[model samples]
Target: MTPHNELRLLPWSGPDGKPCFLSTDNTNGHLSRLADNTEAIQLDLATELLDYASVLLNGAETDSEELRALATDLTEALRDTLRVAESRGHRLPPPHTDTHADDTDSPTLPAAAFG
Candidate 1:
């Protein structure tokens, strides 16, 4: 089990040694008693998709109302998905060995705005 400030990443290996991920943290304590971890992974994918959509919207030359609406929909969907995951006792994955982590247990984001 890997834990971040408020996020935790738990990787589970199947009988065949294949791997998958689970999230366990304050926001997802409800899922701690659940028997499966698929719900969390699904929510993570939805979040990732929303991230991509954010990038697309940010880089677009024309932020049409349709695009804005689509982005809003995706954001709302992501929020709902996260809520469900939490209700199911799951959470978003904690930062792994990725550069996102500051090589410490403290909170670290993608940038170093303040010390």
Candidate 2:
């Protein structure tokens, strides 16, 4: 059995907007394939929406109703994209950490660097 941390985050939600997860060792299984395809479709749709939004926004005669609809669609697409990112992030291998480094040996960056 896969560990809890290793469980796959499914692309779709469950009842009441709860997240859904899949626990399996087979990457090529039916559910995995389905989720993969769904993610691909979602990404494609988001790309197409970006193009449409650019065109719509560039038009001088754009209407309020059309802008509102575009905003709604963009919101949904952003949500899906975030979910996909979270799912894939969890699946990535944990970053390597060094425990033996001396505190004094660490380099410090200026506060302005962060900005």
Candidate 3:
């Protein structure tokens, strides 16, 4: 187990396009460096997706196929973003509603919560 402050959680997609988290305490290690690189790429992709979504929302062609494609991309990007937030404990409910008493008792994310 890793202390919350020491662990660096990097969000990424597997080869099959599934969300995955790489945890590391060594911020300067080789794998950690890779995680940093991967995070950059994912962020870029997310930005591109957002730009496209804006275009669609602001009156683009309304073909069903095109809409479906954009919807799929949007879902993927949002899921990636949420996974990143979840790993950082940023999206949890308020403390009053939280069941866990401390950091050590935090609930684990289900595999399906990823891509």
* Model 2 TM-score (2 dp): 0.79
Error of 1 at 61 (Å): 1.3
Per-candidate TM-scores read: 0.32, 0.79, 0.58
Candidate 2 local Cα displacement, residue 2, angstroms: 9.0
Q: Model 2, residue 65: displacement in angstroms?
A: 0.7
Residues 10-88 of candidate 3: C-alpha lDDT, one tens digit per residue: 5765798765555555667898778657667777899999997788878855888888998998888887777666656
lDDT by residue for model 2 over 1-115, one digit each (tens)?
3333668888899988999999888888999999999999999999999999999998889888999999999999999999999998888776655554564645666899999
- Candidates 1 and 2 compared by TM-score, better number: 2
Better of 1 and 3 by lDDT: 3
lDDT, model 1, position 19: 40
Ranking by TM-score: 2, 3, 1
| Model 3 regions lying over 4 Å from their true place | 1-10, 13-23, 90-115
Cα lDDT tens digits, model 1, 62-115, are 558868777787876665475555543534345455433446656555566755
Q: Order of candidates by lDDT, top first?
A: 2, 3, 1
